[model samples]
Target: MDDIVRQALAKWPDVPSCTGWLLLDRRGNWRMRDEAAQAGGAAGTPIRHTALLAFINRNYEADESGQWFFQNGPQRVYVELAYTPWVVRLSADAGGALSLTDQAGGVFEPSAVYVDDEGGVLFVDRSAPPRVAVLHDHDLEVFSDHAQLADDGVSGAFFWRDGVALPLQAVRRADVAGRFGFVVSPATRA
Candidate 1:
């Protein structure tokens, strides 16, 4: 959290949280969702302004309940996740290292990897407050070069270059929330 945001929160102390106005798309785009977009099932407009994107990314965070939100100075604006709270993108400049891009476009190092039955890849960052993110399907091919389907024919494992094979679960996509301890969408703070 930013010091300025903390000061604002301390000063105002009662601004209602905003919801469904911001979205993080599967492609790592920060979208600005309006009432029309929310009603019409639109994915919101992609945020293009560099300064605004950086501001949003800087204030993005999650609660104890795993609901992700961005601190709009004092007000908490919960993010509508298009996929997962974090979206993993390949960092070409880092020699194709797996970069975990959160809903706000911030990056983190992944400490663990998981693959579901549907070939969905999830990563865990063992930070102070651990976070789990999904690898975007568009980048699966890039990850595939370093992974393989295990002989079970139902699951796969990440073949780390260090010669370590981390086994992953084979769960249905719908079961991901329970298996991962997160809500896909929150009706209220959860």
Candidate 2:
């Protein structure tokens, strides 16, 4: 959290939270939904401002109920998730080691990997309250190159550059939010 935001919260502690106004898309894009967009169930306009994006990323957090939000100074702007709370992109280090980086630019060290029924990949970090991140669609090819499927075609293992093969688990898309403890749409919860 930013010092300025903390000060604002201290000054005005009763600011009501805003929802159905901001969204985090599956491709890691931040979107701003207007009234019309929200009413029509549209994805809204993509937020391209670099500074604003950085600020939102810096203050992003999740509540105890697993509702993700951006602490915008005094008011909490809840984020409507298009998929998981995070969308992670796969990158290779100088040593050709695989690594994961979330849309917010935070390094995500995945402790487990899961493949959904639709073939979508998800990475779960080792945090106490583990976070689940969907693999960016663009990085699917790269991910496939490092993964080996088992004879059953459902199970697999991801081979990292260090020669450690992390076993992959199968997950159903519908069960993801419940299994991971996150709300896909916080606005609906309200």
Candidate 3:
């Protein structure tokens, strides 16, 4: 197994067993939403969403977009949702028409939700050639090099916000092996 994955597993044994999804709403607040029961209507154990939010809030600063990191005890796991190019079929009744798009586009009409192996649903837009919709589907792992403590005594990656150098620490270590940091955003921090 990858070192980061092994490390994450060692630290967070319950990760794989975690079935529900975690969300960062438009307000930049953290919320853990549980998945509904299967065919039998048997619900899985529910985790305290508030508890997780409080935990991340205390450890990391919430940006304007409400972006935050995830931590398991002492190890920080960077959790991010990524958008992938996919084709969606509109008007599925008659086998529908197909269009390609990413996560930024709005919803499409008469589209079938395709759940990938990773439990992420693929949203497609039939109206446009490229469909767009924000997807919080995939669990992307990100890591950081050794961080130096800032004036606040927090260790995080150094970045510039509004032209001022800001200290950003890892709230979540997405990588299990911890080799390289996961680059979730299109823009580079450094």
Candidate 4:
């Protein structure tokens, strides 16, 4: 949290939270959801301003309920996620470490990995309250060695991870919201 934001929060502690006005796309891009776009059911325009992007990245964070938001100075502007809160992009370095960067440009490591029924890559770290994240579909090839389908023709409860065959937990993309304690759309009025 920024010191200026903390001061604003203390100074105006009764401000109402805002939502449905910002979005974090699957590729880790921040977007502004304007009223016109909302009326037409369009995903907002991509935020391309470098300085504004940097500011938003610095102020973004999550609450205890797992609702991620950007502290726009004092008011909390919650984000609507196209997927999970954190989007993992593989680092360009030779080591090929998985990079979990939040909507805000923060980075962290995942303690465990899982593959959903639809082949969506999942990750989590339960050490300090669980935080679930998903790998961006476009970047799946970068971490191909970490997960795969079983050789069997059936898509039953089975999968292979890191060369070890294991039973598939069979998690759905929609169920992730409740199972992982995150809201796909953190709305102040919904």
- The local distance difference test score of model 3 is 0.32
TM-score against truth, every candidate: 0.84, 0.95, 0.23, 0.81
Per-candidate Cα RMSD to the true structure, in Å, reads: 2.8, 1.6, 20.6, 3.8
User: What does the lDDT read for residue 104 in candidate 2?
Assistant: 89
Q: Arrange candidates by lDDT, highest first: which order?
A: 2, 1, 4, 3
- For model 3, the superposed segments whose C-alpha errors exceed 4 Å read 1-20, 37-52, 59-69, 74-190
Estimate the overall C-alpha local distance difference test score of candidate 1. 0.74
* Candidate with the larger lDDT of 2 and 4: 2
| Residue-wise C-alpha lDDT for candidate 2, range 1-190, written one tens digit per residue | 9999999999999889989999999999999999999999999999999999999999999999999999999999999999999999997767778889999899898889999888899999988889999999999988988899887655989986568888999999999999999988886432
User: Which stretches in model 1 have alpha-carbon errors above 4 Å?
Assistant: 91-107, 151-154, 188-190
> Clashes in candidate 1: how many?
0
lDDT, candidate 4, 1-190, per-residue tens: 7798899999998888998899888777888999997788678999999988988888877887888998987789999988887776644346543355554555655566667657787767544776777777876766555445556412333223233343334577778888888888885932
Steric overlap count per candidate: 0, 0, 26, 0
Better of 2 and 3 by TM-score: 2
Candidate with better lDDT, 1 vs 2: 2
Candidate 3 structure, TM-score to reference: 0.23
How does residue 158 of candidate 2 score in lDDT? 90
lDDT of 2 at 162: 68
Better of 1 and 3 by TM-score: 1
Error of 2 at 72 (Å): 0.5
lDDT (10s digit) by residue, model 3, range 127-178:
5333323234221110111123444433433221232233432222233112
